[model samples]
Target: MADLWVGNVDDNTSDDEIREFLIKYGFPSFDEIERYSGTGTRPAVMLIFHDTTPDALRGLQSRIHNMFWKDRTIVVQVMPERDES
Candidate 1:
């Protein structure tokens, strides 16, 4: 299993904003950015892919989240990272 880190950030958050943020720091591609619009879609989020066997992404999850937006807790999920490989 790998990981997919996301951010259900505030509504003001934009795809460009998230994309730039991800790339600027040290995340994967933003080409696959997707949007989920529900009644409560105020806070925007990103879908990141991490492909590490033992999930080195766990540490990255909290670290990246905390590093950039200390105010907001970026959301994360550990799963079978996409088979782009």
Candidate 2:
């Protein structure tokens, strides 16, 4: 599994919109998504890919990182693998 953190998203952007954006950039459909309204300043989302690898996500991360989307400059990062012991 892998987790991708997408920050600086527009508050009005819906989850489905984000999904479509990722798919348009060659990303596979994420398994799940979690939204965070951090300080109400920069909204973010954590997308979980159940069958994807961190390396794979990292490769795709740059496609959208620092890219302008929905009138916001987006930040994309592939989270480190968690130690699920």
Candidate 3:
């Protein structure tokens, strides 16, 4: 599995909009999404891909990292694997 962190997203953007944006950039549909609005400063979303690998996500990360979307310069990163134990 893989986790992707997408930051600097607009507050008005909906989940479906995010899904579409990622799909438009060649990302497979994510299995889950967790939204974070920390301090209402940098709204972000963590996307979980059940069947994808970190390396695969990393390869696709560059396609959208630092790209302007919804009036914000979004940041995309493939998170490091977490220890399940």
Candidate 4:
């Protein structure tokens, strides 16, 4: 499993748009896509996939990284797992 982080996404970009983008890039189905936004800041989206291989995660990351959307370059990266403290 992996959580792919895509930062600097335009606020106007919808989850459906992100889904379509993922589908266009060869992802069969995503577990979930969540958007985070703050006032006066660019929104970020996280694409989660379950039971995914590392190579597949890396491939998705590479494919989405530097991709342009709404005139902003997408910053894609593998999100580190949260530590249970």
lDDT of 1 by residue, 1-85 (tens): 3445465566667767776776666655544445554466435454644334426655555546544363676666545545666
> Estimated TM-score per prediction?
0.52, 0.96, 0.96, 0.78
Q: What is the lDDT of residue 67 in candidate 3?
A: 99
In model 1, how many backbone clashes occur?
Answer: 1
Clashing pairs in 2: none
Report the backbone clash tally of model 3: 0
Candidate 3 residue 74 C-alpha distance from true site, Å: 0.4
* Candidate 1 Cα deviation (angstroms), residue 69: 2.0
Q: All models: lDDT?
A: 0.55, 0.93, 0.93, 0.78
lDDT of 2 by residue, 29-48 (tens): 99999999989989999999
Task: Predict model 4's lDDT versus the native.
Answer: 0.78
Clashes of each: 1, 0, 0, 0
